[model samples]
Target: MIEILRKRRSVRQFLDKEIEKEKIDILKEAVLRSPSSRGINPWEFIFVTDKELLEKLSKAKKHGSAFLKNAKLGVLVIADTRKSDVCIEDCSIAAITLQYVAESLGLGSCWAQIRLREHNDNISAEEYVRNLFVLPDYYLIECIIGIGYPKNKPQGHDYSTLQFEKIHTNGFKND
Candidate 1:
């Protein structure tokens, strides 16, 4: 599990390949097993394979997410905020867990956050998604996770710069 966590990376470039049903099932199982905040489990998932809708979302959220175009599957993790104060947390945990699970199954995944600012305005991207999918008002689109086989492996990053940062604490070491 720890190895999966460490090996996971955001895969942006995906091959034009469809994911297997069995693998998809495993990914969904991870979501079902995710721990919900306060046991509210205020979350739902929309498995998107519609090419037209995927194209629309890719364009609508083009600013932050252009990688959706190549993804074979997009899982929208929605949260019922009215049901729990930690709905965002619940949804976020589910999203991250899904990413790791997908990677464990040899599938690549990337998380796309739905901007609240866009939703606040009637023209928000969230509004576009809600209208497209006919989602109820009670549900909020937390994120869209793009999944598929990778076209290229993720580039490695050197965390040496972060080693001397003021981020960690050892008995409150002063600068």
Candidate 2:
């Protein structure tokens, strides 16, 4: 499991192949088993396999993430903000867990931020997403993850050069 976590990367490019039903089921099980804050379990998932909708979503953002179009599956994680104050954190944990599970299942995944400053004030994108899923008002779009087999291996990064500079032991930092 540690090795899987270490090797997982945001794979944008994917092979032109469809994912197996059993693998998708395993992925769903991973999300369903996530631990929620205060046991609220205030999370909802929308599995998107429609190519047309994926294409539309790929163009919804300015950066133009074409990876959505190639992904075998896309999962939208929504948090019921009306249910708890820790909805965002809970939803985020679920998203990361799903990503890790995907990696463990020999699948590649990447997270796309859907709820941020750009979409909060005015939820045009959110509206589109909600309409696509026919989601009720109680739920809010938290994030979208694209999953599939990788087309190419991700490049490696060196962390040996990185160092913790400002982290304190217990009290205030000393100069």
Q: Estimate each model's TM-score.
A: 0.88, 0.87
As a whole number from 0 to 100, the lDDT of residue 99 in candidate 1 is 92
State the lDDT of candidate 2 residue by residue for 1-175, as single tens digits: 8688667779988999999999999999999999998899999898888899888766545553567888888899998888988888889999999999999888899987777524334555666677777888778888789999999868534456335666677788668
Off by over 4 Å in 2: 117-123, 161-163, 166-168, 171-175
Kindly list the per-residue Cα lDDT of model 1 for residues 1-175, writing each as its tens digit. Answer: 8677666678988998899999988988999889997788999998887777777667646466667877888899998778998888899999988998898898888988774736333477777788888988888888899999988876434455335666666567667
How well does candidate 1 score on lDDT at residue 96? 89
Error of 1 at 83 (Å): 0.9
Report how far residue 62 has shifted in candidate 2, in Å.
Answer: 1.5
lDDT minimum window of 10 residues, candidate 1:
155-164
| Pairs with steric clashes in candidate 2 | none
Question: Model 2: C-alpha RMSD to truth?
Answer: 2.5
Evaluate residue 125 in candidate 1 and report its C-alpha lDDT on the 0 to 100 scale.
72
lDDT of each: 0.81, 0.82
